[model samples]
Target chain A: MSQSTVPARGAARTSGTVRIVGAGLLGASIGHALTALGVDVVLSDTSPAQLRLAVDYGAGRPARGDDEPRLVVVAVPPDVVAQVIEQELADHPDAVVTDVASVKLEPLHALRARGVDLTHYIGSHPLAGRERGGAISARADIFIGRPWVVCRDAETSSADLAVVEGLALDLGATPLEMDPEEHDHSVALVSHVPQLVASLLAGRFVTAPEGSLRLAGPGVRDTTRIAASAPELWVQILGSNAEPVVEILDVLATDLAAVADALRHPDAPGARRTVADSIRRGNEGVERLPGKHGQNRRFAQIVVMVDDTPGQLGRLFGELGDLDVNVEDLRLEHSPGAQFGLAEISVVPSVVHGAVDGLTARGWKIASMPND
Target chain B: MSQSTVPARGAARTSGTVRIVGAGLLGASIGHALTALGVDVVLSDTSPAQLRLAVDYGAGRPARGDDEPRLVVVAVPPDVVAQVIEQELADHPDAVVTDVASVKLEPLHALRARGVDLTHYIGSHPLAGRERGGAISARADIFIGRPWVVCRDAETSSADLAVVEGLALDLGATPLEMDPEEHDHSVALVSHVPQLVASLLAGRFVTAPEGSLRLAGPGVRDTTRIAASAPELWVQILGSNAEPVVEILDVLATDLAAVADALRHPDAPGARRTVADSIRRGNEGVERLPGKHGQNRRFAQIVVMVDDTPGQLGRLFGELGDLDVNVEDLRLEHSPGAQFGLAEISVVPSVVHGAVDGLTARGWKIASMPND
Candidate 1:
């Protein structure tokens, strides 16, 4: 990835050599961004091939014997995170150590049980992940605009906490301070529970008749998209955050049973009300998600029908540019054998009027123009 | 919606006057497509406001008593669908009648219990729906490239089935023949069950701490997108098709409990295996979805980092046209305050190499290039 021309605020906040314990996706991405900020980064991993691949990709240089890192960031998977943090703290006595595991309390509890020194360790998690993992899929901008939670307690000094926070800042992530318990509970609700639910729902499709799947539309596809996740990885994440996840799923099961009971005897008193309340609660829940549904309201969409041939879209987009309309998002939909395709373009509401008028002036078929 | 310039195959397959019993989204959409094919269409609805809105939108004209329809299509909600179908059959004795309700068995069973003459009646479902309903959201192309299920019996004549199948073909839908029992069971797995699961999962988020939702990403968004559906509409759909839906949810609840038990005791023997199997089965189930993940496998993606400025996207799209590469699908992701946006463009696998090289040669920053 090329470095941006924008001025970076990273080098001022973070300095000296940094060591990354795992040369996987998160580790290599941190190295890429830090290296772009003109910082010295050293990366190491158990697999020699993976380490070499990350190093060869300019993530960092090979570890050297004389190198004294100011910070040691452990980016190992969940199962080994506690052990790695314990070892890193022992090896780098003078350095502040932080591990970016999803569940915070589990590893902290494991290290506490082992009687490891707690003064220099902080548990953190970046709420960012891709379907594909490893250095091959790593990008410097993976963490931009994502929430990275840093966990600290009475044992942590402000300076040590700053080191971890600075690392998050230099990588263009918003650092949110959360205690270990709060961090684990939050992720359990958002990430771990959703993963388990997707798996459970998609599992039902395994034995479904072929005719049932033939009727599959965008609705079912959207619900099961995350079901294609790596199974082994999810099992660890779910297991580590079991208490909070199980607590939520238990309540969700109660809801499921209530709906099922209502469906079984729809004529019973309050049966229809039970089913309606389930859906109404779901609507309120999704709307409660910050910044999720706001995206649709922030931008207005206009659909234009264009010929499937080349240059047709180019002309429409070019006209949009000439009108000074900045398209915030775009989705192009066309059936496999259909002769026409629809370009659903999302632009800011203020520019939508001008954008539609400009495209219409250029002889474009306005299939559905935004009025707002 | 404007009429397409391409020659239509609809006029030959579907001719004579057609009557639509509801003026909602599906009814108006069907009317729009039929009117475009040179067929005389008459529309009627229980509400005068709904009828006026659809008629004003050029879907069709107001119904007249002297007008005789060759085909009558009912597009009402599931609860009253059977009553409407029976009335339509009696009113238009010479016409073949079909209903676009999502459930097939419920209406057919209701009609049979009433001892209504079954010779002129055939049950059908389009397997199509949108989040919003009513005439305000109707579109002529809603049914294109979607599966439409038509159910017929020994009492039905070939001419009647032909009339119903012609409606599907004229609207660019693939009409598949299935018995009423098969249609009900198939929809229960694909459409009805998924809706319940989404609502159930999202319902858990209602009481979550706001911090949890701040970490929400595309994964949770995708799984819960369908949860925002209208509760009143879903209540009827689920109630009418309760038998098959309850059957599927029963087995899914068992799978859920097994995983929850394993998560509560992760260190126990076979506990991890239960969790792994849950995820593994989900992966297999999603892979079994025909033409879903196949969309990604059919093309290769190349992500280009473009500055968030006017004309930047236009220039890149223009360059794509110059290279003679057809963009099959696209997704543009940008953080709110990020300095740059990533345009993930999908082109057919055969042309990915050329598109990447061409863009890189033209001085664009190719953040990630397609190797497939």
Candidate 2:
């Protein structure tokens, strides 16, 4: 087996090398980030074209010597991530290896079944992605600030865990230690199921009359944004995490039925109550949500008349810094005739009104005052 | 009976005055936009304080000299919108009177039953609002670029339609002519039902275990943002548009049930097919939605490592403009290390790779690339 000697722990870790297999988006990105940090990176890919693309993107040079690198990251499709990781382990017995797949349980199970060296293999899934794939799409900063879920069981060696965690740290991502099952279940609810819901909502418009679709606005766009995701990737995700995703869908179905019942029987005494109850529940759910970066969700709106002049709207937002109101949402509409524009700014609500009044008193023509 | 001489048809039309009966959010905003356009605006409200607030915000002066305004807008709570419109019609016989209520058919039917002069009464609903209410929240440009559904029946006169359309135009809103029934049905599917659905989803989080709520991000926030709206207003809207809203909900419920059945029996081939079908349908729905404004929906993720320094992240966005990549979405995650931050920039997929490469070449260290 290929081998290399490096300083043991406690010596200020100097430049070391990593071998990235499968020069795809994840692998190339890792190589790019590591290389930027003065780490020597050698990348290997089955496709010479992809390897060249990764190298061209500054991910790393093509693998050179038979010397074993300290780490190997197998960044391939979910179906092949496990196999590649196993192959890498057998090919380089000394290197700690990990796979950056979306799903963790199946890969971990595969390794367990194959009786791979428990100490060198760690399973990880970074909760981040884009719609496009391939080496050409790779970027160094993809993992920064996102959660890198590392699945560890009793068999996972502390040294391997440290290596994976160090890699996550190097990439500027939060390393979250979680059980494989828990990670799958959480994603099924927050990511997979929601994607289905968005897709379902968007699908309705596909068959809508032409005029009907033209009238569609930001609301529909926001709801169905995630529906544009890669279907093949989603199929694999939903297939593997089918149980939990289905469970969440079941809950959504029940809730939807209750709402339908309430709407159907509006004239009944309980109709209004049912509708209100559902709305109230929604309010509670919204309140439970964490705001930006774990902050409390702030709500606000700003209404300003937009002139037809180019860059006029941009200037308005720039001036908002004077108000110190964090704009959380915004909507703009122009009057039909020769008139000024109207822009509604939604912020944290705490300072939105004050900002409106401030701008109004400052010779900025206010559109409307707060109703209350 | 109050009467005024009508300006000669096709004569240089005199500037039309807008009379807002209640200086609430909608009323004050209408008055504000009209007054800003140098049109005569007269404001009135049961609460002198509210009326005074509207006037102070330059919405309009009080009605004067038994003057007959060309148009009267009844902007009040849903429960009173119809009554107020009827009263305004009685007081101003020559004015084209309309109501800005969320529900249309009920108010239109109520006026018809009251034997009000249908020739002069038009029903309109401005599909725009905020969670906050009152003149304090009113803005002149609130309706700009938003659809303002104007409902007309056989009894509506051309002159009346012209006046109402002019008012909508003056407010910088797109005037959509629809039958009252059709308007109600469309809104029930797109607006009212979605509100209820959001509320129901949000409610589920209210009783969730501690820390569960913290997991909510943009998805839940976006889905339930409207849920924070006034419950009482929704009650009136849902009650009035119960029929069509219920119909849509019923269909949704049927689909939901099918999905639920699929989830419950995942092992069964038929069940699996149903589940897949539902997901596929959802995907189709998502694809039909128009991108932001009229643009195609493009998604890109840029991972940038940020330091603790304030405004460093802001500079990155500013630099993105230099690269000529439009950022459509953004998310940030701070790792455990105190010194670094990761800002993920999601742009149109077409430009994501270029942007990432440009930034990396510029010497800003890259983090992790998003998995495709």
Candidate 3:
């Protein structure tokens, strides 16, 4: 248990006062994390109520006229990011300006089009956020253990880039440098396209009969979980990173068409092979995902039935602790109409048998043991 | 806590010995539930080891020569369902034979093509299963409150249909009747296609650069989680339900192409509107999904971060109990390289503020509050 508490990295490396514009999830969360690390943070937002809520939640203090911020974090929406960055650069001459909006290329192009001095402005995106937005959903640790991509160009100074990386580190995130084009394309493949695909797939459920939805299983729920995200925000995101996203979507659409056509004519020559190949490609794709801690190793899962009553899960965890079996990951599944929960605990493969035996001995119902 | 221990509902309604072929997840789960209800259950499988394991898990006893079964459950792989159902029906002449295969139409068509007697056979699919298969993963309560779709034809007698529905009820499932075509089309829309789409999207991650997946977030994880399902099994399911699934996939493919082309030429007329319209459609689609207890009403979510320790979650849940707030649903998010877990608790909208305030007062870090 003690080993689980790894030391919080990035505090000592992060120094100086920072000012954040926009009291939304990213900006406010950065404020909270910096404040927790004893770094002086001043928060500024156009929405006074939002600013007040962020301050009340211990995110940061209101900006003061005398405060000389060494770094200005422009955590605004994607569409308005470039304008805000331009404005921030003009307002704070000495401070390095960095924006946390998802897309980087559009903002850089916009800033370049406006002929703004680009040396002091660094484009960075912390790959961390929740479905819901605003300061109310902000967490100091939201960026912890996430990758923060810093889009740096040749014109950007090393000192300015260092400051932005320090900011990401201070918020407990890893900073990786990438060219704007590469970053945009990477996010399109990994993040942007996945989001749109989820939304589009979930859209199929809209006109489905209510009875059809009653048969919706975990597969459908998980596939569309992110579809519940705000569409207005996503429209802006997909709009900004349209090129790379569309490029990937085009390939996916073509593949889908081919697969559909093949399935349409299964009796056709090579149709079954095509179908099998597509699914096999999917198998290869999912296998590429890094496991917990980026190890890419498989863990055995033990599904235990948990009664709805409180302390049942507590008791289960307590027993697991007593058994000295570390849980690598945990997922609690509860269907809409079900009264109980299914606690799927992922643990090291070596400890599975012992964990199962111990739990069964304790009268805990082991619903499923996949590795068995 | 006491109220949560609702009496198991299916025991009193279930009667007679049920014979289940294929001691896998669905079959073993059915056997377990019926056995718990004090109804006799006879288990069979080609694999002696699987049958022994299911019997050891108390799912049921081995088949006896003189024992008579009132119901015959043919639970096997989708590709083998038709043959298995034929065998079960032929073996148990007086029994009402039903199958729990995911696809209904293909098997019915295959059986018709084989000229198998159809009078005692009823096609049913219980919308309950796990990503992993086999008896070891089976849960007696897997079908509780989930919809069980029964496909009836003109040859099916009313008494045989009632027996199948009664079996569904005995397993605590809501039985819904649909024609074979309707069932196949609906599952394709709600189940089969989602599975294929998930696989295809996850496949995109395979060729992605190593650094790109480092930026993978919850969206990517949720979208691809179902792709981890056994590929060989999925190949069979998609193959068996190929026609309807192909029809749905064709339409989806067309939509993807349109969205892609519109994104490709964003400056073209109506491109942005096309993008926004697609996302808006997704919002409407996800909004149609039922919430807990099949209600469409929304619930407020409160994300509370708990230190990653053995009893941390237990303590938090215990506190929730003290506050007397019933958790409508719960999901735990734990990332690698992090020392804490985020418990996203869903509750009635009215209780959101109080729950947040109470947990905060108890020194829990409320990472996000949906309702503010």
Candidate with top lDDT is 1
Question: What is the C-alpha interface RMSD of model 1?
Answer: 3.0
State residue B101's C-alpha deviation in candidate 3, in Å. 1.2
Per-residue lDDT tens digits for candidate 2, residues B135-204, read: 8877765666677888887888887888887777666567788887777766775677767766765665
| lDDT (Cα atoms) of all candidates against the true structure | 0.82, 0.68, 0.80
Return the candidate ranking by TM-score, descending: 1, 3, 2
Candidate achieving higher lDDT, 1 or 2: 1
- lDDT tens digits by residue: candidate 1, B22-81: 999899988877877778899999999999999988789999998799999999888899
- In candidate 1, residue A295 scores what lDDT? 68
* TM-score, model 2 to reference: 0.79
Q: Compute DockQ for each candidate against the true complex.
A: 0.54, 0.31, 0.43
Q: Write the per-residue lDDT of candidate 3 for residues A1-372, one digit (tens) a residue.
A: 122232243434457789999999889988887877678889999999999999998888999988888899999888899999999899889989899988989999999999999888888999998777889888776776678899888888888888888777666677899888888988898888888887888889888888777777777877887876777778788889988998888888877887887777878898777777777787778777664423424777788878777456656776777787777567676656566777888887888899999999998877667535
- Worst lDDT 10-window in candidate 3 chain A: A1-10
Q: Write the per-residue lDDT of candidate 3 for residues B1-372, one digit (tens) a residue.
A: 112222243444545778999999999999887887677899999899999999999889999887688889999888889999998888889999999998888899899999999999999999988776888888776776678999888988988999999888777677899988888888888788888888888888878898887788777877887777777777788888888888788878888888888877778999888878778887778777664323423767778877877557656766776676767567676665667767777777887888888888999877667634
Q: Pick the candidate with the highest DockQ.
A: 1
